[model samples]
Structures are given as structure tokens and as C-alpha cells.
Target: MSRFFSSRYANAEPYKPGEQPKGQTVVLKLNTNENPFPPSPRAIAAAAEAAGRVNIYNDHMCRDLKAAASEYFGLPAENIMFGNGSDENLDFAIRAFADDGFPLIFPDITYSFYETLAGLHSLPQVVVPLAEDFSLRLEDYRGLKGMVLIANPNAPTGLARSRAEMEAFIAEDPERLVLVDEAYVDFGNESCVPLVSKYDNLIVTMTFSKSRSMAGARLGISFACKELIDDMEIIRNSGNPYNVNSMTSAMGAAILQDDEYTRKNCAEICRVRGWFSGELRALGFNVLDSRTNFVLARTDKIGGKELYEALKARGILIRHFNQERIKDYNRISIGTEEQMKLLLENIKEVLK
Candidate 1:
């Protein structure tokens, strides 16, 4: 049995994603950062129309989705690569860019997935600490001892680095590959995609899982110089010829064309994110200044784990990390206005 599994994964400490309980019917699933709203009606219709696509294998190269994304971004099709989701793109990032000798560097408190990627690949890693405000120190990234990975509008904390600040770092050291995970870019802030035309070393990864509201779709992509795209394409071809199925290609393409849908939803989320923060503050919870579809907040009165368990018992599910610094806080995703009212109502009762 030991000989059957890949040596790399035999002892790999995989990323522990949030639980999806099926046994319970009274569940308010805010544990994962998913949109409460349905995906664009157009996309759902397209997927429905593509139901018979299972009979044939998808285009190994993802032609339709590539064209849609290229048109959306106003870039050449050759410059883009799509995956089952952005995590697939990130896995490609790990395999293509850095090796075991040159490990990746990221904020210690950032997305937990980075640590899992490093461990799975046996990549050497250097974990940098964020400033007291949970914001990244852009200046600290000037001289990368190795490849640097950053999640702008970073996860859990939701703080982001500005475009001017990112451009400054790129200007300082133009040699290293700077991979920017912009999964939350549409919610707020300018994207680094435009810079990819000029900077060959810049690669940005994005997903339809966030602003596009298609987490179940598992669609991810990256933009870079043709050279980087070509390199990743080789790795992709070696592994799965059709990483994204035909039906999903049609679905992703449909969603990409509906920019209005993604924008409208993001605007709603941004508005409600602020309102939810205010409501939490009124109830004496300290919420972080969030720019994404989620908020991080803490209560001075109770332990985070206690609050988390309490919320779960009440059929409301929010996230509480067991880590030292973040354990004091809960990362809650912004749902619809009505769902949020219920979440807030339950929290008030739980606190008492």
C-alpha cells in the first residue's frame, strides 16, 4: 500500500478546507467564502444547454473559454491559461516557478493554502509576518531571496496592497517572478493584469469562485508573458489534457461574458459588507476594514472558538481559526441582506 501512493503525497499535510455537513438540514453555510446569490441566470442556462456535452471530450486547449476571457481582458488568447479552478492554477504556479531549492515566501497569516502547497511540493518556504494592522509590508518584499507569492486583498485579513505600491516593487526588482493572486480583485482595487503586457516576470491568477459566484464551477486562470503561459501549458499537458470539461468551458465562457452580473453582485456585497461591519460594531465586535466579500472581526467578551461553536449550535456557520493571532477573530462571508439579518440576530443571542 505504501508503494502504491506517490512518495510526495504519502506524508503530505493537505490543506484542511471548511466542512460541508450533509447530515444536518438546519445549516447556514458561511464557513466557506461562497456567495449566497445564485450564479448568473445566463450561465446556469448555458450549463443546462450543455448537459449533453458529456458525450464528447472537451477541447483539450479550452478554446471557447480562452476567447471569452481574452475578449473580457482585451488580451491575446495565447497569454491566458484556464484550470478546473484557481487552485489548479496555483498548483501550476508551485510546479512551474519555484523549485525545492528556491522555496516560496508569503505572509505567515495569509491563505493557509500556501503552506499546504509548500509542504506538498517540498518547496523551501520563508513566512514573513504582516504589520500590526494585518496589512502586508510591500517594502519588505524588495529583495526576494526567492519567488514571492502574495494575495492582494489578502484572505482572512482582507487588506490589500495598492497598484502604485505593487508597481514600485516590480520596478525595484524586475528579475523575480511576482505571482499575484487576484481572486478578489473585482470586489475592489485595480488588477495587475494590465501590467502583464509590459512585465514578463509578472503572473496574476484569478478565479470565478469569488466575484463571479461560481465556487462549485472550479474555474481558475492566470495571465503572464507568452513564455510563462507556454511553460505552464507544458506542465498542464503532461498532467490532464482536459483540465476543464466542455460543459464547464461553456459555463465559464457564459459567466465571463456577463460582466454586468459579476459587477452587480460585487457591488451588493461591498455595500452589505460595510453594513454588516457597522452592525457588528454596534454589537461590540471589532471588524477589520474589508475590501473583499468577507469580514474579519473579534469580540472582546468571548473566545473565538467559543463564539464559533455557539454560532454552529444555533444553525449559523462562520469560520474561526485555531491559530494564535487569528483565533481571536471570526472570518464571516457576506451573504444576502436578509441572510445577514438572521446571522446578526443569531449572534446577538449567542453573545448573551
Candidate 2:
């Protein structure tokens, strides 16, 4: 152990990412919410071509990628910004708005990373309880005098708030900064990016990990008013000028332009999600109504911990939270149709 370790990191609890077990026999990985599809062909080519440019310093401004994304969203370049990944942008947004003086607010059962972000920054947090069915009540944040963060079509639960509900909330109180994390939005929900042009306090962040099938590339984008974008830029610039490296920036430009490929992949995943939900229900499991790329399911007789291990021993991996509230349920990512069929088949044996 080093005696000169930084005091700030002495008690830090870093976010625990889903396991990526290297060198082990291949398993059907459904633990992380990654797309079970290849990236756009153009993105593959762009990454290949970008390999030759690694020696040179990437454009710290990431202008071309920013312009491409701006064109895709029909927004101005000044209204857009990019980050190494959506998680990085999430952390940046938190630092930009919330601090020790003003606490951040989000659902208690939401993304586990939110809590880790609180500890990482030495900031206090207010965790509001979700409904019995894991739905967020925007009314909880209404009139609250602090920054608000929400994952739209939120993680694990895969539920979304109605657009009309959000609009009314914004109209009623437009004081505190609100950021919507749209990591899973491309699956089957409306993004709040369009709301940014009208509401100066609204910021929407999105990732290419799920829909674009670029989890390894790590690209994130956000749209907001020029003022809000400027604030985010200040944090990013002072932190990491070249957050989006050359390969990721090039691939991001290519993937954003491949709208047709993205749509086809998303439609395929949604179909699998619907079928998967019905199959689990037929097996006596209660599946949550999901609009994103995953389903939350609970067995009538099997425990989540037991089922998780049973599936893992059979070389299939799915997410299971050990918290008391959700310990009975498993958050399963919608794999490819064939992979899901295997999950259905193996689960029968595991339960028996």
C-alpha cells in the first residue's frame, strides 16, 4: 500500500461496473444492458480508418463530431456537447449543478451509480422513494429547491414518465436545473432533448451504448440551451479537453448518421422484449412493463439470488440486485432472439 495516497480517495467507493470476466469460457452476457448486435457498418469502417490517426492528438474541441450530432438533432452546435461516455456526462452534470451547499435529488432505487457519485464528490444526496411498482413520482421533485437528476425510461425498471406529466412539471416550476439521463431512450420512448429549446433549465443526456451498439466506443451527447451547454463545457474543459478521443468521435459521427440501422436494431430488441416478457409470465413470473431494452422479472417460487447463480452456472448471466426491496426480482437484458430462447429453455431446467 502507498503511504502517499490522496486523502480524497481514501474513503471513496467507486461505481461497481457489471462484471466483464476475461479469459473465462464465453457466457451469454445479459448482465449489462448492452445491445446484442453489431455497430453500424459505417462505424466499424470509421473506427478502422481512425486507427491510423492515433499518433496525433485528437481535436480537443471535437468539432466535427459535435457538428454531425447537431445536424442529426436539428440543433445548433453551440447547444450540443459530447463526453467519453454517458456516465462521465452524468458525473459532469452533477458537478455542474449540485454540490455540498445544494443537494441532488433522484429515486432511491434508481441507478446505483448516482449514490456512488454522491460519495465521490463529497456531496449530500436526497433519495426519494419510488412507488410500490418502481415508478418515479415527479411530484416529489416539484417545488424542491435543488438540482434534480432522472434516468428517462430509467435503468433496471425500464419504466418512463409520460411526456405530458413532465411538461406540466416543467411549466409549474422552472427554477432548479433538471437533467434527464436518456441512456435507454432509443428503444421505445420519447427523448426530452426537444424540451431543451423551450426550457432553459432542462438538459438531456444520451448514450450510443444501447442503440448504436457502441458500448466499447463510449460516446455521450447532450442538448441544452447555450447557457447550460456553456456551463457543462466549462466543467468538461477544465476536466478533460479531449474526453471523446479520435476513434470514438469518428465512430460517433458515423453512427449518428446511420438512422436506418439504429431503427431496425431497436425494433428487433422491442419485439424480443415483448416475447420474452410473455414467456416469463407463462412460466409464472411477473414481468414489469418495460419500454426500454430490458425486463424486470420475479418468479413466484424462485428467489432472485438462487436463479442468478443457477443461470450463471449454466453460462448465462443476468442482473440481480441484492437489496431487500428488489431481491426477489432479476433485471434481465433482452438478448438476441436465439440467446433469449436459450435463456427460456435453460431457466426451465434451473427452476426444476
Candidate 3:
């Protein structure tokens, strides 16, 4: 530990993100759950135009982006908030809502960022474990008395709870705030965005990184009751008022203007995911049913660490968590058909 660091942050354990390899070689990167396709041509054009306006500060209100989001989701501008990324939105939520007195509740096996955010804010947290099959049980969360955060079609596992189940969980405690991260919802899972209007306590977050193929742009969207959104706006304005860049804002709005582009890309990813899962299962791997663009699987023949190392040696990068209960599983993002075929061929060579 550095003696120069603040005492509060000295003991903090930061989240480890996927590796970003830099070299001349072509890397088959299926580690980070990013879209393998290019962004919409319209979005690219808009971003190129906005790049010329780099001298001026971006609109702090993100008015045009919110308007585009409103048209796409059928929600008003007052009900939405944009962030540099969904991580920033999640951070704002933790900072705005979580407290030492009222604990934060989330799944033990969901996104690792929740725990990191709680630690960063120094908020008490209650982690509910998922069922043996990695599915969430609403009964487990029935009587919790704190703000809730759940990643729909959860990361690493890529399994989604039904919208009815989520609604029931939200109805369980209307007074408490519930944050639903639908980062991968465009793949196949049912979204709780429509429920924001029905339940004032619900805050649904989405990201352009996944579906819109704009991970580099770092655009995130949040939907909630106008009151809750107002509170988040206060938090955002307090920090960097111009959180998103002009290029990102313009491109994000342009991408949202064409839903078909994202839908088509998501459909192809889902198709590839299903095919990859079947191939892995046929090879004696236990592939979990995934609605997102990634599959979590483990082989009885080889350990997760071993498979990860082998894939790395072959230049096929997938994710392997060293955490308990998940050490045996590897999370592989779905790429193009050619990429998947190459991965399969490499896996065959590696296993042999």
C-alpha cells in the first residue's frame, strides 16, 4: 500500500476488467462482452461531424441524446439520464442512494462492479446467493430492506430472470429503490424499461456499448421516475456536468435513431451464441443457457484455468474468473461465424 494514498481508499480492492491486448497480431478477443460488429454508419458519420466541434464543451443536459432515447423507448426526457458509461450511472446510484445506515443488496454471482461500488462508497451490503443453477430466486429477496441492484441477463452467467419475476420483486418493496441493469437485454432478454413508468422505484439502465457497437464511445442510458432521475441529475451535475463527449453524444443519438441496425446485430450474436453453446456442449462442456451475447461453460475434461491458458496460447482470448464456485467456468463472448469457427477449430486442437 502507498503511504501517500488516502486512508479511506488505501484498503479498497478494485475490480479487474478483461485484458486488452496490444500488438500487431490479430487477436480473437472474446474476453470482454463487446459487440464484434462495427457501429452504425450513420452514427460513425455523426461522430465524425461532432469531432470537428472538439473546442466547445458538450451539452451537459445531453438533450438530443435524451430526445432520441425518448423516441426509441417512448419515455420523456425528464425520465432519462446519460453517463460516460453505465458504470458511471451505477456509481452515481450508489453514491446517491446507498448509505451506511441503509445497506445495498445484490446477487453474489452477478457483476463484480456492485461489490466494488459498495466498497468505494463504504456502504454496507447484503449479497444474496443465486440458486445452484445460477438462477435468481425472488423469494430470497422478499424481505430485504435496502436499495437493490441486479444485472438482468446477468454477466458471467448470462442468465435472465423473467420480467414477471422482476416485477414481483419490485412490487415486494415499492418504497426501496431497485436498479436493473439491462446492458445485455437487446440480445434476447425481456427488458424492465416499460416498468419504470408503472413503478416509480425502478431504475433501468442500458448501455450503447453492447448493442450499438459503441463501446469506444462510452454512452450509457438510465430510465426512472422523473423524481429519481432528478436526484441522479443532481448527482451528475455535482460531478462532471459534461460527462459525455460531443462525439459520443451525437453518435449515441444517431445510433438510437436506427433500431434495426442494433437489432440485426443482436440477432446475429444470439444465433452465434446458440451455435457456439451447442458446439461446446457436444464437446462434453457444461454450457449454461444464456440470453446474452456470452456463454459460461466448463469442461469436465479440463479445468477453467487450463482451458483459458490453452486458448490464450492459441490467441483465442476468453474470460476465466478465479472466484469461488466459478473457477471452473469460462465466459466466452459470441463473435462472428468465422471467429467462432476459428475458436472451435483451435479448441479441438487444444483438447487433442
Candidate 4:
């Protein structure tokens, strides 16, 4: 460790992202939950146009992007906030809303980044366990008083609660701040974004990475009441007012305006998810009923790590966590039908 390193983060365990393998390393890359399709043509054009104007500083407020997002989300511009990605918005929320007195609370097994963010901010945290079937028990969060962050259509498990259920939970405590991470909402899960207008204490964040096919662009959108957004904006401005670059802002606005493209891609991914889950189940794997573009599955024939290793050896990639509870399961992101068929063929060969 460097002598100049801060002692505050000496014990911090940073979030580990999925491995990014070179194209030649794996024929099918399905570890990270990125959209398999290309982005809308309009978004690509907008980005190209913006790239020409990069000499000028980006709009600190991201006014044009926010206006497009506002129209798309049916909210006032003041109620929306943009960040480098949803992770930044989540970090900002933790900084702006949580503390020693006001701790952060979320499911013990979901997203995993919430814990990282809590650690990074040096904030107290309360971990609530999910139900046996991996469904979130909202009742467990009723008595806790703090900022709550939930990853809707939660990672790995892909299980999700409906918007009504979320609203009911939010109504249970008006004083508590609830942050909903809807990064995978477009893939057949209901979003809590609409509730932001009705609930002042609610914050909803979405990324253009998944459904919008702009993971490379690094744009994330957040919606809340004006006051809550103002709070997050304060935290945002304190760090980097022009967090989103000019090209990204332009691309994000164009994609939002091209809602049909996003919708079509999400619908196709949902279809692929359903078919892939059925195929996995047919092959003696226990696959979760997922609402997102990924599935968590395990088979009695092989250990999770063994399966992951075997697949990687055969030029395929999937995510396997070393965490105790879910160590035996693997997360596979949905790709195109042809890619999935190739994956299935490889899995069958590996099983044999």
C-alpha cells in the first residue's frame, strides 16, 4: 500500500465487476448483462454529430438530455438527474441521504454494490435477508429507518416485485428514502419511475446500458421529486457538474426519443430469456423465472465453478459468484438466438 493512500479506505472491499474478456478469448460473452443488439441509428448519428463539437465544454446541467428524458419519462426536467452511470447516481444518493444516523438498507443478496457504496461512504448499513425463494420480503424493511436501495428485477436472481407492491412499501413510510435501481426494468419488469411523482421520498434510477444498448456511452438517469433531485444535484455538482460528456448526452437524448427501438430490443431479449430458460430446464438445470435479460441457474450434474470453468474452456463465458449462498448458481446474460443455441450446444457437450 502507498503511504499516501487514505486510511479511511484501507479496509474497503471494492465491488468486483464481471470479467471483460477479449473477443478472441470467448466466442459467446454472456457474463455481463449488456444489451446484445446495437443501439438505434438515430442515437449513433447524434453521437457522431456531438463528437465534432467536443472542443467545447459539455453543458454542466445536461439541459438538452434532461429535456428529452423529461418528455420520455413524463416528468418535469427539475425532477430528473443524469450521472456518468447509474452507479454514480446510487453513490450520490448514499452520500446525500445516508449517514451514521441514517443508515442504508437493502437485501443481503441483491445487486451487491449497495454494500460497496455503503463501505465507500463509511455509512452504517442494515442487511435484510431475502425469502427462501429469493423473493424480497418487503415487510422486513417496514421497521428499518434509513435510505433503502432496491435493484428491481434484482441481479442474478432476476425476480422482481410489481410497481404496486413497491408503491405500497413506499407508502408504509413517507419519511424514509427509497431508491429503486431499475437498470433492468425494460426487460419485462414493472418500473417504479411513475411513483416518483407521487412519493417525495422515492428515487428511481435507470441506465442506458442495458435496454438502450449504450453501456459504452455511460449514461444513467434518475427521477425523484424536485427536492430530492435538488439534493442529489448538490452532491453531483460538488463532484463533477459535467459528469456526462457531450457525445453521451446527445446519444442519450436521441435514444430516449427513439423509444420504439429500446422497446423492440427489450421485447426481443424477453423472448430470448423465456426460450433459454425453458431450454436450460429441459437440460436438467433449475432456472429461475427471470424478469430481466439474464437467468440464474444451476444443475445437479456440476458445481457452479466447475460449470463456469468448463464453459470458459470451450470459449463461452458466464458469471459465477463465490458468495456462500449463491456459490452453486451461475448467471448467464441473454444474447441472440444463434448465440444461445451455440451456448446450448456447448453446454450439452460439457454435460456429456
Q: Tell me each candidate's RMSD, in Å, in order.
A: 1.3, 1.3, 1.1, 1.0
Q: By summed lDDT, which 10 consecutive residues of candidate 2 come out lowest? A: 18-27
Query: Where is model 4 poorest over a 10-residue stretch in terms of lDDT?
Result: 19-28
In candidate 4, what are the lDDT values of residues 1-352, reduced to their tens digit?
A: 7899897885477999998886556788999998899989999999999999999999999999999988888889999999999999898888999989999999878998898988887888999989988889999998899999899989879999999999999999998889999999999888898888899989999999999999988999999999999999999999999899999999999999999998988889999889999999999999998999999999999999999999999878999999888999999999999999999999999999
lDDT of each: 0.86, 0.87, 0.90, 0.92
Q: Kindly provide the TM-score of model 2 when superposed on the true structure, using C-alpha atoms.
A: 0.97
Q: Model 3 residue 173 lDDT?
A: 85
Q: Each candidate's TM vs. the true structure?
A: 0.97, 0.97, 0.98, 0.98
Candidate 1 local lDDT, 72-189, one digit each (tens): 9989998999988898999887898888667798997888888888888888888888988888997776666667888988998988888888877766777777889998888787
**Candidate ordering by lDDT (highest first):** 4, 3, 2, 1
Writing each residue's lDDT as its tens digit, candidate 2 over 213-306 gives 9999999888889998899899999988988999999999998888899999999999999999999999999998998999999987899989
Candidate 3: C-alpha RMSD to true structure equals 1.1
Error (Å) of candidate 2 at residue 28 is 0.7
Instruction: Show the colliding residue pairs in model 2.
Output: none
Clashing residue pairs for model 1: 84-218, 85-218
Candidate 1 Cα misplacement greater than 4 A, ranges: 1-4
